[model samples]
Target: MRKSPAAKAWTRCAVSGIAAAVALSASLSGCGLPAADPGNPGRPVAAAAAAGSQGAAGNPAAVTAGSRVLNPANGRLEAVVPEVSRTVLLIGDSQSEPVDGWPRLGLAAAGYNVYFCGRGGTGFVSSNGATGNYIDALLRGDWLLPSGTPALIVIQGGGNDAAGAASDRQITANAERLIAELRERYPSTPMAMIGTLARGEAHGGGRRTEVDALLGSVAASHALPFVSVGDWLTRYGLAKDLADTVHMNPAGRQKLGVLLEGRLRDLGLDRKPTADQQPLRASGTRDDGPGQD
Candidate 1:
């Protein structure tokens, strides 16, 4: 197990909400709000007031539970793993498509099975051209989850909304709608948000960072524990860590996973589920320790 002395130190940070996120960003080598490129300046994003895969693998062509599968969407493959109890439901986009991706590895390190629900190019209201948005997918039964209530319901996405034509208000409205539905379905379950992984202006960061802050505002409004990673690329000096214009390479993914684990500790969202949410463990899965089988 990778003991988290770093995570333990991070839990002491007073980054209670995204408001503190600005300070955190500013503190990191001047990694403050991204430079204006998408026609919007810094900090005004938060002033807008909130609006709104795969894993484990070592395979490409194979389609196992922890491998890539054809996305229910129109374009390429997405990561997937079967649902299990004592899990965290991650609903997000292509950024979360790697079965061995950032948040999945981070959350697994935090001690929980993960079940992903969204695919590439999708967000709260934005679609991947074929599959519906997060809310629409849930309503249309495009993404099915396990029967039992999971430990936590984490809503993560914003890149698609930011990149696509959806306005901030539309993103907020759809996000709220999705949250309302999730609250109805899992009343006792706690929820959280992870903002978009982004870069600075020099790295083509603009609307994506803006959407990250906007989602932070939304999470703040809902009083959800939000991890604002909007400035992460520039902050962590990850310019070379990208696999593409929008996604991260394996090295970048690993580094961000560690960073995310620390943030989860900071927000006190790293604990495992309670007795009620801890149903019988699924077969072939072992609860040896945090991040371990």
Candidate 2:
């Protein structure tokens, strides 16, 4: 409809106000979160690139530790069997709560073929409250073990599950079903259930014990290794070490990476690089393509 100049001006003003409000809402939603730092890499083992950098020149321990952490031999888990052949599948929420620089750092340092299959707000329970189809979609999708049978499957989720309207039994059952499917699909693969970390004061005391018990029982029933972050948080004082209620800071991520590195090693799932090998990250796809579940 035709409008006078004054009316047109008012319409423009209203549109601009709406845009401003939308932008402000987005900004507010991102509060209390660490902006993704590709530089941080979140690897428990230091990166080789960083090793030659000025930082590592001064601190040689960083490089040595990186090699040690990545060296499958140094991983002393008796159950691991220390094999050079293995790949990793990382499934979790934002608070799968990795240790330092993550995905880039931790996966790289560990030298495993890591497929990070985590989506924000998706959890073992709720299935996004029956409306969200992340899990079912993932199962039908093709996000896991691209290199073939992964020696280990690391399910690092449950934070969102706890918050979801679904019952604890439902969450635990879903997780168990997932593990059972993995076992059926890849019988040789060992499943590792990494429990969610404790949120600091913001969550009114984290690590829902009810959920923990459920996860533990399911993991035990399946004979899968269960690593609880609850002990780490209690031992380390989560409030002091955590960056926030859920996510960990750089130091926290690193510490968590160290713990996972050990766990992965014990599973005999850590891989080593060969002289002729090229780094996977140099050619890795940020998107593993499409979901399969």
C-alpha local distance difference test of each model: 0.61, 0.47
**Weakest 10 consecutive residues of candidate 1 by summed lDDT:** 284-293
Q: How many clashes in each candidate?
A: 7, 26
- TM-score for each candidate, following the candidate numbering: 0.65, 0.55
Model 1 RMSD to the real structure?
Answer: 16.8
Evaluated against the true structure, the overall lDDT of model 1 is 0.61
On TM-score, the leading prediction is 1
Residues 1-293, candidate 1, lDDT per residue (tens digit)?
67486555344322222222222221101001222312344533222211102222343334333333333333223223444345677777766655555666566556566666766767887776556898888776566444346678788788878877679999999989998888877778899999988885556678888888889899899999999888899988876887667677666666676678778878888756676654221111111111100
- Give the Cα-based TM-score of candidate 1 against the true structure: 0.65
Show where candidate 2 strays beyond 4 Å. Answer: 1-85, 96-111, 127-134, 142-147, 199-207, 266-293
Error of 1 at 15 (Å): 26
Q: What TM-score does model 2 achieve against the real structure?
A: 0.55
